[model samples]
Target: MFDLSKEFESFYKNKVVLPNDKQNDLREKKNLNISRLKDGLNEYNEENKTDYKIINTIVQGSMAMHTVVQNDSNDYDIDVAIIFEKENLNDKGPLAVRNIVTNALKRKCENFKKEPEVKTNCVRIEYQDGYHVDFAIYRRYKKENESEYTYEHAGSEWTLRDPKAINNWFKDEIKDKGQCLRKVIRFSKMFCKSRDYWVNMPGGLIQTVLCDEKIQNSYERIDEIFYHTMVEVKNRLDNDINVYNPTDTSLSLLSTKDHEKKVENFKNKLNDKLKKLDVLFESDCDKSKAKNAWYEFFNHDYWKEDTSNEKVQKYSSCYRNTEEFIEDLVNINEQYYVTVSCNVEANGFRLQPIKKLLRSLPKGWLPHGFSIKFNVEDTNVPKPYNIWWKVRNVGEIAQKRDMIRGQIEKHVGNCKQEHSDFFGNHYVECYIIKDNVCVAIDHIDVPIE
Candidate 1:
């Protein structure tokens, strides 16, 4: 059987997992919001004299499970359960408890960019920086010789829920299956993020169910495991089957409106991904092809190779060569004739003054700045050669001030920096370096005031 386990594993480690710095940043932001919520709730309780009080706050969801993927857009969603002490909850009702938490958050975080909003189960606090926290309000109480947590729903009223139990179940599954379970879940979440139809899919709950039923081992090839899981999930959704919360038997996880359309879209997208995966794993030597397939599957730029370092290296080499070539050319072709002119209105430096080179600036004019254009007047020099510009300070003091130095494609180049500081003669040199040898050179003394 064809296998791309090594490639998938590398991709998971390099691309699927969130970087430490990003994870820390998300954690720090989440903690800050949690602190704000706690302070706000405490002040609210003291001021209002309401018996409703937050007893505990617990971090739940994919964030707590470490299954989150790196989101370059900073759109991270964190889940927190704000457990309240059960007192007069039956009389106050679930809506009342949810509203209390929402009001407290709004009062505390009045300065936040986005106002706190109420969802079916949680009070969402959205930050301007692209991260949001969902505070699920739950009332905890001892009833019938057991402690239970109750969450609110829009039309159904209070429903039995144990976020801690659900979190424990995920944790236990991860433990039993090893880190592979976590990796698989993260990959699935990333897959969802890649496609538009899957973006609104219930990622966390679906991942949990798949881990429990589909994935059998930690050592299985990731592409194989992911494909199988996708097929199974698509099948279940196509059949209109309900996925139940492992912790609460009565709670159905798939409760989105227009379930049939969602399932159809999901199946279509899943087939596309499966086809790509097939091409990816079918060949071991064509890693680039596989990477492209994966990129198409996810539709994210994070899968692309980072060429920043390569660009820096190339520019550095070109810069060094230009400098050395200019030095050599200046020494060899001292007799070469080149003309340099400056135009203030056009903001250009002209060499061999073309008609376009406006002579609007008077000599010694240095107020608005100018560009330096240079062309080789020598006919012996070959055509289509590279040109470089170098500026040096030459006065009685003879101190070399910093100047903008770069290679120009044509015979014309611009001085990126203005000559405003000194009123003296500066040497502007242009050179043509051919085959690692300086073939022609020209120099002009530019007066700057």
Candidate 2:
């Protein structure tokens, strides 16, 4: 709820301004990336003709939105939509032109590298230098009887609209001309990693900026508000990570110099892409769920969830002996042994240590909620797909000791909905230890966004 200038003032107090040279270089790079993409589009046009002209490329993302960046910034890549007219994309015009335009890009991107190794028609066509170009074939729909413009989404095929007409459509609301409020939101999110910060900071900053009288009126331009927010955020980043943690040096035996160079290169790439907004992830990933997440691999980020490749068989197996199941569960839950033993019935047969199903749910559906879809795959299941076993819920987490933390996927067995209350919704596969006993795990870091 803090006001903008006040927020900026507090944020600024913690920031260390970059030397003019560095700032200028960074700024210049930002402009250069923009130019590169623009030039590429122009080249695309000259080489090939389309029904609709690509009027302008508007970049969306972090850099464009003006977020707080640290010394170690990454290229967010550029996201550009090919703006055209509605009438042009049809059996003959823009749709056909799209093919030619896409071909034009096959030439070269950087130093002889043809980025965007893969290209598809309707979806986004992404490339290097951190650029994600989307052909948003727009059109002003109408009949030959009357020529008026109406808008629509070009379903997975080649579609069209006018260059001026198309650009005008988006310009009205999502215009780049101005709107500075976003910068404040960016700064506050990095500080608090909360979207709520954005809503609150603007009112406060507007109040403070108005107090200056001279600059008060400029508030109408969103970019002005944005630039101001960036100025403050940049300052904070400088004072924070760079100043403290003496041991947190970028130097290493592997040529600290080389690493530093790559860091800058990466930062540049990130910044350049960021300008387009493709790199704009949900303000922050909710890894909070990961605090208690289990460490199955040296670096969990290294391995991915390959669930699509898996075909899990669901079957119910009541342990032939209840005590034996409990005993095995106790052993696995209590000890960190490499493996454990169990017995159960599945598919009219008996098997031990059942293999669970790993699902590939729709994106943003990860226990991360409705907006984030992860590509985690299933692994660690022994051969012969089905493992039969019977068990009970360890019960709700009662205290810190009860909740074990690790990423888990909901595993559903053959049990019908009426068979188990856990049927319809898959419970989080947890990796926590309660009372020194191994437990079901849930990652804490996956952001709710």
TM-score of 1: 0.61
Cα deviation of 39 in candidate 1 (Å)? Answer: 1.9
What are the lDDT scores of the predictions, listed in order?
Answer: 0.59, 0.31
Model 1 misplaced stretches (Cα beyond 4 Å): 1-3, 88-90, 144-156, 196-200, 216-219, 235-241, 280-285, 301-449
Q: Write candidate 2's Cα lDDT for 151-266 as tens digits.
A: 44344544332323322322232232222232334333343222222222222222212212112124644324544444343344334312211122342312344533433332
Count: clashes, candidate 2: 77
Question: Which candidate has the top score in TM-score?
Answer: 1
Q: What is the lDDT of residue 345 in candidate 1?
A: 31
Candidate 2 error regions (>4 Å): 1-52, 61-72, 90-99, 112-114, 117-135, 140-148, 154-184, 191-449
Q: Give a tens-digit lDDT track for model 1, residues 24-106.
A: 46666666777787777777778887555566666777766667786435778888877766664545676777777777777
Clashing pairs in 1: 349-371, 349-373
